[model samples]
Target: MLIFKNLGEMASLEYLYKYDMYFAIFQLTFIALLGYIILSWLFRMWKQYKQLKNDKASAELALLKSKIDPHFFFNTLNNLYGLAIKKSDEAPQVILKLSEIMRYTIYEGENETVLLKDEINYLEQYIEVHKIRYKKTVNITFTKVIEEENISVAPLLFIMLLENAFKHGVESLTNNAYINLELIVKKKTLIFSVENNFEVKENAQTGIGIENLKRRLQLIYPKKHELLIHKDTSVYKTQLTIQLK
Candidate 1:
């Protein structure tokens, strides 16, 4: 039996024990809540950073593809002007082709991916436009074998190679200038090969377009693409392979 002179002087060990336990539980709950909040904030920040990086890449690619060479448009326009003055029967066809090319470049080129067939058609149109501008005979053969259907690719991925081939190969040589291109799509893979004869001794394999293409491949395809270049005394050959997802 115990008797206390003052009731307030009595401190029960059981009550003290209960208080300690509740204080510890409260502390743990508070720490857990703080940790959860911090982690959630970090996760949100990481997601925002990733999204921003992707958006930047997309913007850069759009700028790159939208640059369809102002010189090309100027020359085509000047040529069309002359043809129009002469009332040439081919003026309408030329104008139509030009319009189609512009439409595709302005619209479809901005897309992340486009149909392989559409890209092929755009390439053909580009070739036709170039052929019309030159008086010299430029033998260009583009062959394609697409076994896989509904395939998609990053837009304007191969135009730089074609542009480089013509700029260094066909434009410099006076005779026997040729560009041969082949595209093979099979087994969920796309292979594009270009071979051209060049006369320029230097700077045949270097250009802004090709450099940008390299950057783009790194960004878009990463490990899924392979680009190979072969050069000899008078020929430049390149092959690009892409693994379709």
Candidate 2:
């Protein structure tokens, strides 16, 4: 009877030890599983955070570009009205040209990018109107070295610089000031250079348009473009180069 009791006790103790070992393993496994779940949730949250940040950036960029369009449209319309009031006889033809530009500015300008041909045509019409406005005082030349007509570019980019050249370049001309515009496309790069001769007084200020233009460029192209402005003696020069992807 004693021997039987001792064997029974030893067996019970051994069973307890095995049960304890199993319980310890279960606890460790539960802890490890919980830690894995927590780490997985954190990783998912990080991904979501990055995605939201990118979305917000994209939204902000779209809003900024939207703001720029209205400012540009308002300015162009004001200029057109001034021309119409001054030159009533040519107002009809000017209205036609203005309509084309308005169509493009309203519809196409809202897009992220536009066909290069459309931009070229829009600029041509704008220059034609300017020619009518300042016929005798302003001399304008446009040169292009593009091999293809189906290229795409960011909208209203070059026009901003062109408009600035007209606004600030010719106001100080004594005889006849000239604006030379050039566009060159080679491989994957598009280059624009505008040179204007002007008389500079002591105090000269570049207005909101230029600043707004710079902001637009930064938002759209980021690191894909370069803009250079130089004033030497009596001439002002602006050069812009952008890589088209």
- Top model number, lDDT: 1
Per-residue lDDT tens digits for candidate 1, residues 125-232, read 989988887878989999999998899999888888888888878877989899999999999999999999988665544557777787888899999999999999
TM-scores, each model vs. reference: 0.88, 0.75
* lDDT measured at residue 165 in model 2 versus the true structure, 0 to 100: 75
In order, the Cα lDDT scores of the candidates are: 0.86, 0.80
Worst 10 residues of 2 by lDDT: 64-73
List residue ranges in candidate 2 displaced over 4 A: 1-89
- Cα lDDT, model 2, residue 226: 90
Model 1 residue 72 CA deviation (Å) reads 2.5
**Sequence-dependent TM-score of model 2:** 0.75
- Candidate 1 residue pairs that clash: none
Model 1 bad stretches (over 4 Å) = 2-11, 201-206
